[model samples]
Target chain A: MFRQSLAVTLINLKSIPQRPGMSIATIISVALVVGVLLGFSAMANGFRATVQGTGSQDVAIFLRSGAQAELNSGLSRDEVRLIEEAPGLARDSGGEAIASAELYVIVDGTKRSSGTDANIPLRGVGEDAALLRQNFELVEGRMFAPGSNDLVVGRSVQREFSGFEMGEEIRLGNNNWQIVGVFSTGGTVFDSEIWADLGVIQNLYNRGSGVQTVRARLENPDAIERVRAYAENEPRLNLDVQAEQAYYASQAGATSDLIMYLGWPLSIAMAIGAFAGAWNTLYSSVDRRTREIATLRAIGFSGFPAFVGTMAEALMLSAIGGLVGAAAVYLLFNGVSASTLGGSFTQIVFSFAVTPSAIIAGIVMALVIGFLGGLVPAIRAARVPILAVHAD
Target chain B: MTEDLRQDTLYQLDHVSKSYTRGKERVDIFTDLTMQIGRGEFIAIMGPSGSGKTTILNLLGGIDRPSAGEIAFKGQRIDNLGQGKLATWRAHNVGFIFQFYNLMPTLTAIENVELPLLLLKMSGKERRRRAETALDIVGIADRAGHKPRQLSGGQQQRVAIARAIVADPAVLMCDEPTGDLDRESANSVLETLQLLNTELGKTIVMVTHDPAAASFAKKELHLDKGRFVEREALA
Candidate 1:
């Protein structure tokens, strides 16, 4: 039975190229479905990686009680002073608190790929901000001196935007800022920001001694609960506090979920169309070979082998389609940089990542389509009348 | 008086009945039909259209079961066999040829001939050798590489004959084997069937509308209204 099944399956597959019109059409349709699905999935993955990779667990962020993002937070200097006295903060070598009072604002920048305008975050940080970051590297030139109009840009911003190379001066939002240094934060969202001294930003914008949010190094990863408890008790310092890692992960959810929302519906719609094409292809394949299948059955070949043969043909075509789609996306989009609005409404620059899991997901979808498409027709092939062999 | 037809009978149909439901109407094809076919006999079934000539061929070949009656082959009941067992029985006991020369259009002649051997557990080399030998016996070994469409009707029917005999089946069931062929092609196919029946001792039950085709068989049974109206021996 196994040998005859294999033989029948081999014959069915060998005949696929002879009826290339419908078979190729089915394969191309499945390919389009997988390509579209994986494209969006890879986009979501890349964006998730950038957002989630931003901060470390040992660093905690302080935002206003009702603020969900830094841009929505407002922290007075008096409240900042009270929070700085909280017991769980780590201290530097000089016993100074390892914290940064940050000012967040958005400025316009042109994308290098499309020359279209996008919102870029201009974050003003205190002296200890760089110390609180994990693996903070000044890749080129020097950090901006305090109270200077010099600006240091992230490597991603420099790579994706124009005129941000070292020593180059550029205008952003009605101010001329000298690009002094380029920095990297290991492909995190921080790599998409432009940074300057907090004091300079406050003074130039005529803003009072107020900050949007604060970053403080915790004594340990577990110190965040103490900070959250302290802020809950102090009415004047009442604020939302979270470990920086959790904060960025929270920031990643909305955008990634939105991407999945768009991807699933579109992919499903395409899948339905592909399923119809595959059904038509396999149905006609069985129809065209009805007499031959009957002859096989009449000659003592069981119906099981015929059923298996038809299913094998369906699955093989869809498998090939899936592989073609995956290879196309892998070559065309993997590691290709793109940017989209993150939870903060600023463009987070990232590169597409065609992960193995995404390819597996695409292939599984292809197989499901193949299986559903092949089912009824394979049954038909199996139930083909043996009397057809004696048709006079 | 004639040695009790059952003595050498290969097929014994006792009180068989067959009916087909066409929409709301039930059309009775056969009623309490009893027949016996002796072993190693080349019998031609001749009848007009819709007279159940092909139906008898179907029932005898184990591809179709009588609605009521016992069909025995070699003294064992085959009418009650399930579809799977029926297929195994047909693979071991019967080979078939159709009016259309029902060869798989996409396969070469040898591949079509090798199809039946796939049901048996044999190595590929032996299967190919047997298929080749069958083609040689049918005088079409050189055309093994050609697909059905690439061959003439006579050649296709010859390939069909080769496929029928490739597995060394006990009986060959032919349904209008020469119905679609020209005079010369029909003569050639009839001669091949005769060769298989006489030389290989393969029992052949052939259905044909032509008397000339029936003349090639050792005996002719004329069916009318699903009954054997006349049985004639051909010299």
Candidate 2:
């Protein structure tokens, strides 16, 4: 039976080229489905990589109670001093704590592409920020001097927004700010923020002798519990404490979840549509070869061989569709940078990632469509009546 | 005449009844039909469209089962065999020819002939050898590489016959084998059948509407509605 079915399957595949009309349509439809599916999921994956995964557990973030975002959080001068002195914080070689009291504010910017006004995050941080964000590097020019009206712009902001070029100055909050340095944070969301000295921003914006958030390098990742307990026990400094990675992960969820929600259901629906097309194509294939199948039946080829033949043809066509889809996504979207609104309501630049797992997922989806689509038609092929050859 | 043929009975149909459920209609094609076919005999079943001529051939070849009858092929009851066992029975003992030639459109003439041999546990080289010899016997070997569409109606029927005989089956059942061909092509196909019956000593049962085509057979049985009404034998 195995040998016979193999022979029948070979014959079925060879015959497809003669009637390429419907089968080709099925292939194209399935390809488009997989392409769309992979493209959107890849975008979501890239979003997660940039916005959520770049943070480390060894660093902790503190936000005011009931505040989910740094932009909406605040720290009093006393609260800042208290958290900075809290135990379980990592120390630098100079015997000072590796912590930074930070302020996050959205500032106006001119988009490079359209010259339209867009809001970008401008973060004010202490000197320890350089140590806490391990991948931060000044790619061009010099770092901002303390107690000066100088700002270091993120690489993405410099590339995407105008007036942030090296040595350039832009007016913000009634002060002239010079773009002294351009820095990168290894493709993290921080790459989209402009950073300035904490004192300069605190004075210019009249932020009331406080910051929006405090970040500290933990003695170890597990020491987050000690920090959280300290914040909770100090009622005057009642703040939410979490690992930086967890903080970013919480910030990353809504957008990536929305994109993924759009991706999977849309993909599955399109798959169902492609499955319909495949059903029509394969059924017509069986119908058109009715007499041929009947003759094979009459010649003692069992129904199982016919069933096997039809099923093999369907899978081959679907696999071709899957490969085409994967290739399309890889070529058109992979590593191509784009930005979307993040948890902070600011553009977070990221590149689309067509990962191997995404490709495998798309291919498996195509195959599932093929399998469901082919089942009924293959059974019909198997039961094709031998009398059809004599119906003439 | 039927009793005389029973002396070398290759097929014996006793009280065969056949019907079909077509949509809401129950179509009765044959009732209590009895017949005998001799070994090496070439017989033609002549009838109108609904006369159940092809049904008899199908039953004898084990392509179908009798509704209520006993079909004996060389004294073995084949009508009672299950579908799988009947398929094996048909593979080893029967070959079929059909009106439209029914050659697999994708396969070449030689490949179509090699189809039945795929059921056997023979080597590929031997299968090719047997298919080649069958094509040669049908005089269509030169066009063996051509697909069904490339061949004329007569040539396709000849290829179909080659496919049938390649398995070395004892019986060849043809249903309107030359119905789609022109007169010259039909005559050519009939002559090939005659040669297969006489030279190869293979028993043949063919159903045809044309008397000219029936003249090639040793005995012609004319069926009307359900029963055999006339029997004629000619040299």
Candidate 3:
């Protein structure tokens, strides 16, 4: 039986090149499905990498108790000072704790491509801001001076927005801030913000002596729970404390989950169309080969060989389509930079990442479609009567 | 016909009846049809359309079951066998030739001939050798590399005959084998069938509308409405 099946299967596959029109129809349909599925998944993966890359386990963030993000949180000068003095924080060479009381606000900026106003994040940071973030480095020009209305634009902000070149001036509220430098934080969300003096930004936003969040470097990674307990128990600091990694990871979920939810149904719908095409192609193939199948059965090749032969043809076509689609996506979309609005109500730039797992998933999905598409037609082929050989 | 009858009978059909249900109506094709076939006999069944001649061939080859009868091949009841078992029986005991030359178009002449042997436990080399031998016997060994479309109708029928005999079955059942061929092609196919019977001693049962093709068989049975009206020995 195995030998008979193998013979029939090889013969059926050999006939595919002779029927190029029908074979190509199935291959192209499945390719389109796999391409769309992998494309959307890559976008979601890239967004996750950008958002989650901003966090570190050795750093902790302090936000107001009921706030969901830094943009909505606030702390007064005394509250910020009290949280900075708490234990388990790393210190600088001069013995001052490495903590930054940061302020976050959104301002309107023109996109370079459209010249239309979009919300861009304007962050306020103290002098110790660069010290707290280990990944921060100035890629061009000089850092913003203290007590000056100077701005250091992120690398992504410099590339995506208008009028943010070094030495260029942009008005925010009533003050004009000069773009003095460009900095990068290893493709994190911080690469999408404009940084300025903490006091200058607080006064410009009219929130005197108040900051939105406090980011501090932890002396040890395991000291997170201790810091959390201290902030929850201290009456002077009515705040919530969490590891920066957990906080950014939570933020990453909202966007990635939304993409997945919207992408799944679309991918499924495309897959259904591809499956229907395959089913139609196989049905026509069986119809054209009815007499040949009947002859095989009459020649003592049983129904099992006939059925398996049809299924093998369908699976082979689907596999070819899957491989072509996945290769196209990886070559054309991987590491392609794109941007979309995130949880912070500002554009976050990221690259489209076609991970290895996504390709495997696409191929597996193709096989599933192939199986479902070939089932009915294969059974129909196998059920062809041996007596049909006598039919005129 | 009775003088040439052999004592070793191969097939026995007793009181056979076949019917089909056609859209709420029972259409009876044949009733009370009885026949006996002996080993190493070449018989031709001739009748008008719908006279159940092809049905008898199908039943004898184990491709179909009798509706109400006992069909015994070699003293074994074949009418009650399941589909899978009947297939095995047909594979080992029967060969079939069709009017349309139903060879897989994707395969060459040798590949098509080797098809039946693929179901048997044989090595590739042996299968190839046997297939070539069958083709050589049918006088088409030179066309072994040609596909069905690449060959003439007469040549294609020759390849089909090679495929039928490659498994060395006890019976070769042919359904209108030359019905679609030109007169010359039909003569060639009939000559090949005659050689397979006379030289190789393969028992043959054929259904044909052509009286000339029927003349090649050793015995001709005229059937009307599923009953034998006349039987004649030709040689």
Candidate 4:
């Protein structure tokens, strides 16, 4: 049956070239609809990838429990020391626990000649921060000197926004930090930030109580439960313990949810337009082939079978268009960066991430459009009178 | 001769009146028309424009239900048959040869001939062989691979004839089968129709305005305002 249907589908496909306008119109409409679906899904996946890749599995982040975002969470110096000294933390080569006091601050800066003010995320980390994240690599110049007012801008920021060029000095609050190097964390959220010494940012911003959060590497990621229990039982200090990966995952919840909710309605609306285009194209096609359909009907083809043949033709055409649209999204939007407001009351620059999942979504959307649009016209074709058609 | 006509009735149209309504007006094309066609008989129905000549063909082919009265096919009353069943009935038992040949432009001559067989549960190879045999019978086997657009009018009409008989239907109905062809092409198409009637012992009913085209039929029925006025049998 598929072979017979395929033969008829090929005939329909061959007719497309003769009616180039109608065929191309349908293809482009479906392609654009599929492209939009792919785009949104890529953005959501990219946001998740960026945040998740920046965190380490063996590392743990300490933030106030019940706090929605890290920006709203605060800890004292004693709490930071207690987390650093906690057992189950991974030991470095010198037998000292691997830990870092980190600070996050949002600053407004003009983007070179454009002079458009944009919020830039500045993350202040301890000396062991770079060593903890294995994926982070310095592509140009060198890492910031310890205890100095030096900073490394993300590679994406350096290329897209001005003033992150090597040797250029950018003002961080009241002090100036020279952009000595640029680093890339492969398209993560970290690629859009500037990294500095934690002490300087705390002092510059008058945040004297402690760093925003304390991060510690665990001896074994599986031992996170024991570490969390220890942090909760510590009588002398106030602390909250969570796997670094889990914290980043939490940060992505709001954005991922937003994308998922928006995707359905947007795709459905666009699909209506695409389906209409497909219906119009298929209706005209069925009309042009009235006599052919009549012949098929007269030859013992059931109306339902003829309808199935038309739908098969539609499905084949939509699948082709879907692949094209997905490919277009990959080539044009993948890794493209833009910023949106974050839960931390700051701008988060993220890139569009293309994955296997996004392509599947696009193809499914195209098939739906084809199915909905082709059904009615196919039935109409099947119901046409055979002898009436011959008379025409 | 009269005894031969009494063998068995293949088609019975009893008081089959077809009326079409347009907006607020009721237009009756044929009122109380009665006719019968015998098996293995070649018949031609001729009339002036608006005389419901084609409407009678449509009724006989199960393409449309009459406004009133009975249309019996093979002794079965088909006047009130549902659309779905009518479709099945047409597919298994009726062959239609349309004016202009109406061969699918994208299909080759043999493919068009094999179209009817696609509805059957036959293997592709078997369908192809059958299509080849049909084209051979029509003497157009050499042009089996040629698309309708690639063939001349006469060749296309022959291909249409091949399609009609490929299904081995009980009745072959042609509506002005050679109306769109030139004189030479029309003669060829008429010859093909005559061959199908005489050589294959197939029942054929043709509707045409051309007197020469009507001459090839074994019998001719002249219709005036949906009434059969004259019935002639060729000697």
| Tens digits of lDDT, candidate 4, B172-226 | 9899998999998898888887888888878899999988888888777787866
- What are the runs in model 3 whose C-alpha is more than 4 Å off? A109-117, A170-176, B1-5, B231-235
Docking class of 1: medium
- Runs of candidate 2 with Cα error greater than 4 angstroms are A110-118, A171-176, B21-26, B229-235
Better of 2 and 4 by DockQ: 2
Q: Write the per-residue lDDT of candidate 1 for residues B78-175, one digit (tens) a residue.
A: 99999989999999899899999999877899999999998887889999999999999999999999999899999999999999999898899999
lDDT of 1 by residue, A45-156 (tens): 9999889988999998999988999989999999899888887999888876799999988889999999999999999999888888888899999999999989999999
Q: What is the TM-score of each candidate against the true structure?
A: 0.94, 0.94, 0.94, 0.88
- What lDDT tens digits, residue by residue, belong to model 2 across residues B105-220? 88899999999999988999999999999999999999989999999999999999999999999999998888899999999999999999999999999999999999999889
TM-score of chain A of each: 0.97, 0.93, 0.94, 0.89
Could you tell me the TM-score of candidate 1?
A: 0.94
Model 1 local distance difference test score:
0.91
lDDT of 4 by residue, A1-392 (tens): 45446556666666666667877788888888898888888988877777776677888888866665678778788888777778889888888878888888887766653668777778889888876675789999998887788898888677657677899887756788898888887766677788988887888888885777778889989768878888778887556678888877888878777886897688778889889988998888888887777766555565565576677767766787798899999999998876655567655677888889889989998998888888898888767666546646
Best lDDT among the predictions, by candidate number? 1
What fraction of the reference interface contacts is present in each model, in order?
0.88, 0.73, 0.82, 0.67
Query: Alpha carbon lDDT of residue A38, candidate 1?
Result: 93
DockQ score of each predicted structure, in the order shown? 0.70, 0.73, 0.73, 0.53
**Looking at candidate 3, what is the lDDT of residue B15?**
89
